[model samples]
Target: MSNIIKTIDVTDSLENLKDVCDIENGRIAGKIFYDQAIYEQELEKIFARCWLFVAHESQIPNTGDYVTTTMGEDEVIVIRQKDGGIKVFLNACPHRGNKVCFAESGTTRGFICNYHGWSFNVQGNLVGQHESGIYEASDFDKAKWGLKEVAQVDSWKGLVFATFDPQAPTLQEYLGPMTWYLDALFDNQEGGTEFVGGCIRSTYDCNWKIAAENFVGDILHAGWTHDSAARAMLGGSVAKVSDFEESYSVNWNGHGYEFALDTVGNVAVLGESALNKYLHTIKPSVAERLGEFRSNMIGAVSSCTIFPNFSFLAGQNTVRVWQPRGPNKIELFTWVVVNKSAPQEIKEKWRKGAMMTFSPTGVFEMDDGENWEYCTKTAKGRVTAAQDLYIGLGMNSRASDTSLPGNVFKGQLNEANARAYYQQWFDHLNAKSWKELPNRNFGKQEAE
Candidate 1:
């Protein structure tokens, strides 16, 4: 409790912005979605400083395989090395800041700048400049002119993440207890997971946090927002409006997941029978490896967000990164992840299932985008921006001691995870350094 108090200051506006979220009271200021200053601050304090998902190892398996992505606002290249290590570098050329990698993804021995013919190797070392010895007299060195590299890059279960802050904790340490839940999906099978379907991208006229928070623990909206999609696809067997047995898990660094225990097979709207059969086939192995709790999550429809802006749906097998474009806009990149060792039939089914449910034109995806767009649009109004949004559901409920991780709330219909998320966001925005950040536990008494 003392640690929590030290991190928050509701009355302070030292940086020309009010405390947009009050985690202790479960109130979020609407202006957070529409304010430019807050958005810029988030880009600096959250996106630049925190670990962000770049690409999965499966996406770039071979040497020289690469993917272009954004780490905060800077474009970067995530490339594989000959030594079996991963490296990330600024996509811009050192000479004139022109982008060197133009393709979205492909295997190439090296990248050449189209603007001036400057070239860099797979390791990001400048190999060929347009003119050799042009600046030799000026102490120009190709060794010091390679593409700028990210301070840190690491992978966890094939998921690649990069950070600009060298002082930031390792990926595993930053992920903390969230890894327990992630492994349940990523490492459930013997061969682990791989990104299968080609990426689906779309833009939303809403703040990126809106989408991230929704995936984090907003099951409250599924019953209404996605009701039609569920009914149209599953004939009313999925996303029911009735109460269901569910649980919520939150981690120290703001990562969270919400899952329903009873709606396992019913959640996979595409080829439910086939998917269910497959789950049963793999259940024994998964249970033996990850224990009963995770094995039981095989077919359960669950949504999770990895802190800042990476999110995914477990049952649908869709993973996404919400790339922030501005205070009220985002370009969403999505992919379907599947068990690497799954039968071709199972992988195809999961791929098609993700396309049907969570793709850009997906029934559920469109509905969610509409809601978030309007939510952001409304917040632009002066009256709407000043109102406090209530997120107090299950705030006062007792924390359940569980073998899972973080603060485990007993039911899924709780805002406990969202509250913890905003608390972490607030703490990040206020902290001057990583060492100054507080160890926030949201008042949970038990320790893992």
Candidate 2:
């Protein structure tokens, strides 16, 4: 056995790293959030290789419409093509590395670098440069000077994603069975979902993963964190739903969700008159299209995270991207999403409700930012960074059932989903290549 062990090559860099994350033991070192080296590695290995949500198709519905966003720390432009497809490119000029597009979002035939006269067409093809004679002495190929396009771009149910890795799996394959839960909000009607309000942006002094994990399955915090907001809106304390039937799910790639079996919208802070009436009227139609199980979830106020950074709240119809600024900061971009076919009043209600609950000035949003900021600030200490943070809640309590597609546990107030998230995080950090990623097994047994 000693000889056999000696023959095994152990040159992998991740193996040498200590205190990264121990998913099997359900412990995550605080340094992962405060360490500069780990943050840089995450940009290369995780963000660059993962399918990141860039924008909703509705945000750029017409040809030439575009939005500026980020993939990890790299600024990117997501644009609609004349061919009804979408394209994403690094938002930088190939000439002098200056930014090519400065506007947040707008419709344009092409982008012209403000720093220089170089121009790029809607397809990211280089069209012109100041005085063609400047490069006459050499072969300055315009075709090669086009914007640096992202390796892959795709959309699922109006949500667009892009990856810097050409070998990354298709968006549908990347999303996996999580689509079933996403459809609870996305596919509630025939027209699919559309972004209603303009995007809201805020900077938080917290690690990006802090927000991602919170959305994945942290319903436990809702009661305490948003207690004041809950009291003001509901005329009582945060409603106790401990007795309600709930479930949590985690996919192989770290996507996760937690939802309860509630008939009413749990997170809707808007007045109960118009929004509740509209949901009640549409409940049967939602049931018909998505089946009864998902229909029951339509207004249950679930939270979900699509692996690395995208997350949404179902009842509030708020979708956000937790854009990583660094190990200690995140830029959050939020938008209100509603069924495209919903009544105008219903859409407006969702828009206002999301603003009141999750926007930059939102009651709940302020509280969450405070907690995450303090957690991150305190982690900067040597003693705090050295401690092991426990995330073992409900570990090994998962059971298979027919109700959901991924690993489903019986209750919402558990950290099984968080553990699964860190498991995949460790996997991504350690993997030398995408091919080295574990297979799409949804259970702990299979993962082992």
List candidate 2 stretches off by more than 4 Å.
1-18, 439-448
Candidate 2 C-alpha lDDT tens digits along 34-115:
7787788788788878899999999998999999999899999999999999999889888898999899999999998987
lDDT of 2 at 249: 53
Q: List the residue pairs that clash in candidate 1.
A: none
Measured with C-alpha atoms, the lDDT of residue 152 in candidate 2 is 81
On residues 58-145, what C-alpha lDDT tens digit does candidate 1 reach at each position?
9999999999999767799999999999999888887788998888999999999998888988988878866667767677777877
Whole-model lDDT, candidate 2? Answer: 0.81
Those runs of model 1 whose alpha carbons end farther than 4 Å from true positions after fitting are 1-18, 237-242, 263-267, 440-448
The pairs that clash in candidate 2 are none
Reference-based lDDT, residue 337, model 1: 87
